[model samples]
Target: MQTSSFIGAVDIMSTQTATERPILHGGRREAMREAYPAAPQPWIDLSTGINPIPYPIPTLPAECFTRLPDPEAATRLESIAAAAYHVSDAAMVAAAPGTQILIELLARLLPQQRIAILGPTYAEHQAAWARGGGSVDLIPDLDDLPAASSLVLCNPNNPDGRIIPPARLRALADHLAARGGLLVIDEAFADLADRATSMAATLPHPAIVILRSFGKTYGLAGVRLGFALADAPRAAAIRTALGPWAVSGPAIAIGTIALADPAWLAATQHRLTHAAATLDRLLTDAGMTIIGGTPLYRLAATATAPDWHDRLARAGIMTRRFDDHPSWLRFGLPADHTAWARLAAALSGNRPPLANHPDQ
Candidate 1:
């Protein structure tokens, strides 16, 4: 049997290793099936903190598939995104399959620099930096930020779902700028409601680069569209680094229509707000203490997060658990009443408490 080597040193294991591991995100009905061959597919997947009710996908033009994306598609998408975010058209935006690629491109462009990343957050930032020959420092606290050449932060961080305030971020940017360092803020989840809280509009003192993902906000993860916002020169640098035709024609078409639709944006926010609150109350009533996060999802723990996750899985429900901090689990907000009921029932059942608190 042919087998592949581990992708990175992080997976170097002394013990036995598997041929392949399931990808961490939800929508893993097939993997779940492979793991438990007899089990039914999950009724609801609350693993990813994605907006449940996505912005309505409109009819695609036939030309989107027939023709290659024009170079102008990137420019038009940027213009539409600027209007939506209330930023300048000259802010310089570039789209890729997703923000993940954009991040990798950034890391590659600055390979010699030391990169500081906020901890217990997205693992890709570290992976991308390491892949590009950049050393990474995990900053658990804002004060721990090293004198690195670049910093990456995930606002309203993943898994934990805690929002780092905008003012604090701005201050950090100022500090980094004074030291001649750059800051990259991944605000993929902030669009659920806190759009105004983003520093993307300000073009602040520090060479701050903001990343926004369409997958989380517009529920277009499969579409694989994301953008970077930065000043003209910095944006030009990243653009030069990325080269041309980086974004797809379908992505450009969908993003332009979606960004221009205020009605869809407003409606999604309202639906997500209501759903997230309901999910929070349901988890809280089931005896879990809600730690953080906004209307899109909630982070909670009652000591038995792992056990609870397993129990929920057995009952055909899937939620997200953190590798770095096992005590915390994240649940994506359910879109409708049926999903909410399923999740509530899973939580209501009694389960044994965890023996040791991971956070402690």
Candidate 2:
């Protein structure tokens, strides 16, 4: 299989003699709000696969606001995460504001190495590597990956939500290890349902690093806490790269509580499982194909994905649509049945009841 080169706005400068181009519109909340104005009831935000029902956040102690967190607070959070993931306490876990920070840190730490990335996945992984001065080879298939110094992949990949089997991923990791190459698994969404399938539980396989994020699973993206798990030395190396006090006090407090609550985890999993199945059936019944996903979200594609996205947005519903693959769309399971009905009606070309409202 031939690999396509991963290009970003920066690469555009290399080809064009022009000095500047229009600033790219980032998908920040402000921009999204402007592009899709909120309706009276608020637009349904299903663009992200974050948990619709986030772990309940408790009021923090006065110290959380009074001063910086004690160093031990981060350590305690790491310990809780390690136990939750069934990894060794000595595995060298460190928290950052989000997994994106960890990915950037890893990229900087491994600068000058040739990086191989699975494409049409998270744009940030490739962006981070490129920004850190690493040469990237974007491979479409695992077998097509070149013998590179580093590899990065998003398990249950984004946009399409296809999961690379754990056993197969391990075999690939072993292969990279044999070649003195590092394999980095971004398991940001793996906790949506399958924990046993995560490589993070048993990593530091000489050349393996795993990233886990609390944002998607616990719906704490606002708090922004995530972890990097590896063998002691590599973990220590990544920690050194991040330096001290990277995670905020509120993030540490919330992440620790969320990871430790097994009951919440179980309940969230059950909810997502049922919701995902329902979403799959609804899309299928509407003539769209539910091609892939885990329990967190469904990946569907039809000749209508682009138009459907526009139609839904006009109906006061927001969803994720991919530009690179115009036919594909990702839908996060809404917490309420009413939202699902709105989505189903939109997909079926039925005007939402609210369409007749004067406000709409």
Query: After superposition, which runs of candidate 2 have C-alpha atoms over 4 Å from their true positions?
Result: 1-29, 36-40, 350-360
Q: Output the number of the TM-score-best candidate.
A: 1
Q: Looking at model 2, which ten-residue stretch has the lowest summed lDDT? A: 1-10
Q: Candidate 1: how large is its RMSD?
A: 4.8
Tens-digit per-residue lDDT, 5-53, candidate 2: 1111211112112223332211233444555564325667776778888
Clashes of each: 1, 0
Deviation in Å, model 2, residue 230 alpha carbon: 0.9
* Model 1 per-residue lDDT tens digits across residues 275-324: 77877888888788888876677888767776777677666676776654
- At residue 174, candidate 1 shows an lDDT of 81
